[model samples]
Target: MFFILLSLFIARVTAEAAAGGEESALLRLSDVPAAQAFIDSSEVTVIGFFETDESRGYKEFLAAVKQIESLSVAVCSEEEVWTKYNITSDTISIFRKADVHQKHLQLSETKKVDSDGLVRFFTINDIHYITEYNQASAVGLFQSEVKTHLLLMSNRDMSDFNQLKERLRALAPKYTGKMLFVLVNGNARVLEYFKLRSRDLPRIAIYDADSDRKWLMPKGEISAERVQNFCDSYLSGDLQKQNEAETSEDKTEL
Candidate 1:
């Protein structure tokens, strides 16, 4: 009887060990403490979080997180976890330690990491401009004088909007492998000059081979220029630094 009991006990222990090994291979953000402990005991640690459909501005965030090789992720709702962490907005927060509170602080100023780290959102409204083109007129003269006068008379309404959009489209691919999201804050009456309705705005806009998802404001309030400035700042890499810290703890683990 004693010999039979010993054999059964050994079998159970082996099975438990194998299960534990599999569990250790995958890590989640909510399991931060265990993950940190693992990092302390192991050579490296990686964790991943999924952006949900409920998050208003996080459509592009999911793709950005997937680019990190160390992270293992899945599709799931972030509402409960985000509320627990007091994160009201759609964003990704990465850290080297287990303390969630400290990690939140570090994420506030995180920088874009190559093409994977670029995230953007916008709000545009109230763009009204008028212009006319004459096919019989000289192409160069018509462009220079006639177009210039119409734009000037419109009080900067149509000044450089198209040029800026083209420039952003050209640079989009260099920052993010995918196109960034463009949100219209409200007031699309300005687009009436082109006979475009708020809802009829391009669902997908392309520039220089890059394509971005576009959304229009249902109510229209902010100006298009303000929206452009906001986008420029988000893509400028001024707000945050990539993970470049070399702490003694990190070095010792290596």
Candidate 2:
């Protein structure tokens, strides 16, 4: 028992050291009074809880977070915070943005997550991650407690995709926490696996995870009004329900 305690203590010390508790980029529970005070005072602040397993992903995570929000990383060593947040894993990341409740980016502490993965994790506002790593993210969407999954599938062009993103951002506030929105690539393997397609540049699709049903937007039309109507119809059960094992082809409207 003494040896076990010693090992734990050593691990904790090592984790803290590796996380650079001294660096201003990372904060500690000991810094909570100040951190919380800052969060309370500031209009926007994002704090990241990083597992202290000498995980090399912190550097990449921190860099990516810097692009959108200034995030301060901390070792997941705070027993009080961990228990309160129900964070039982060593690799989970939590973010509290702009006075809202906390949000989580669940990833593997054991595996290294790339910058693109980190980007996707952060892009998902209050929804599931839209990732292409073996369709795991799509599978995660299917398993999510939320019944709605709004996925944006687009080709290589950024113009149409950007427009759709803007529309999604506008709709996010209206939906609040009722639905999940994710932006996916045009050539995502998950789409192929599900036989979903986007032939005419960009498209929007909805998945009612509860019923295991889906709805695809007709190609070539992506206006805010149309997207809004689609969402409204789904909520009102007015959208066409696609088969569980259906595959649609890419037909050009020439």
Candidate 3:
């Protein structure tokens, strides 16, 4: 009789603990103060609200979020999060250090910068790292050099593909050794860009050598010049240093 009573008590305790765990796991956007406090204190916070079971896109987005360091992510209904943030649209919010929030806000209004320009930015969409099979056989050697890693497909058109390639090539020299480039997918705007632009080029893949991860660039008509300008304005300092180092090495060989 005593053992039966003890068993029931243990079961009750276990059930309560499980219930508490579930509650803690939930990120209640209604608790705005707590959410804001977490964002202010953490070095980086990533907030995403989307329907889980119905959103194939969100699943991939979550995978990318996992790759970032010191990033806090919460998945919930769009309506809930929008209500909490007092905004409309299902979007991702990234918060950096509290000290820089005001400055970042100011900069954000002036111009849209590159990834290196800010402490963090939304990827815009999921990345699709392509394999060799998706590449063009005619440019096999160049593909091999790039490792034929990831490809962006915004639409069925070929112009977008060319634009993406040109942009990546221009940007590659800038981030040669420092930061890795990320390609986003599933954006309607990006797809529309590709549909209206070039449509004959083969699909290409973007790779991250450090992590060995691949991301496909979204199909779009992004100008190579624009990409280059963006990189030059934001990443010129780092690229210049890398170029200098290479020049020094050549001189040593001489």
Candidate 4:
């Protein structure tokens, strides 16, 4: 089983790096106590085991992890780490948020794994894992000059938003550099300050830096078709948008 899992991970490593980067986010470790502390402090961890850094999975998993936040990756090239973890061979182990619950994934030894799969694995139990935005970073997100954004405002459970991810991920590469898709928690002070209503539990909205306009997707619909069509319409200049008005009711239902 371990050998199969290792082989599967090695296969994923051979695939091309995704759009973002080749940088690795591995945190170097020297002791078991420190590793335990790291596990306790972090919500998730991905540790790659190898006798040396030369393993292909070591380089590949490290690079794949950089695209994700909150996931700590470390290369256990040292024999002490191997003995401590009881790993006799190469593998990528995913440690859940808790201190002890963890299991290695076979991750489809036959299928190719991409950045999407790695991110999905981090949030596998609930696929709608969205980034929470607060007052501090709100400006950078909503007003960035470099790219427009498709932002969803929601704090609902993963089940509510998970399905839309596939469509969003597909649209991402098609519109690369032009738009970034983000999810902001409903509890953000900035969102609360906007006086957004509870009826807006899950809202699809876009921020256009070019026109300084905010476009809201039609209400109560969050399907992939809605997302793709909305983006296509907006980018093609067919969708009408409005500014963030003073009144609670905006031009769009959302």
Question: Per-residue lDDT for 16-75 in model 4, tens only?
Answer: 232234433245455555455545544456666656666535555655676665555655
lDDT of 1 by residue, 182-254 (tens): 2222234434533455444332221111212222222332344443443343345321122123345587889
Clashing pairs in 4: none
How do the predictions measure up, each by TM-score?
0.22, 0.52, 0.29, 0.41
What digit string (tens of lDDT, one per residue) describes model 3 on residues 1-254?
Answer: 45444543443343344434333333434234445554554444566544442433444444455455344555445354457665443444555331122111222243443333222343211111211122232132122223322333343344455456445644554443233333434444433434433343333334433344433233344555544443453334554455467789999999
Candidate 4, 206: how far from true, in Å?
0.6
lDDT for predicted candidate 3 compared with the true structure: 0.40
User: Candidate 2, 116: how far from true, in Å?
Assistant: 16
RMSD to the hidden true structure, all candidates: 23.6, 11.0, 17.5, 15.4
**Is 1 or 4 the stronger prediction by TM-score?**
4
Q: Which stretches of candidate 4 lie over 4 Å from their true place?
A: 1-145, 188-195, 241-254
lDDT of 4 at 161: 60
Q: Sort all candidates by TM-score, best to worst.
A: 2, 4, 3, 1
Local error of candidate 4 at residue 220 (angstroms): 3.1
For model 1, the local distance difference test gives 0.31
After TM-score superposition, the amount by which residue 216's alpha carbon in candidate 2 deviates from its true location, in angstroms, is 1.9
Worst 10 residues of 3 by lDDT: 124-133
Off by over 4 Å in 1: 1-51, 54-57, 72-80, 98-115, 118-254
* Superposition TM-score, candidate 1 onto the true structure: 0.22
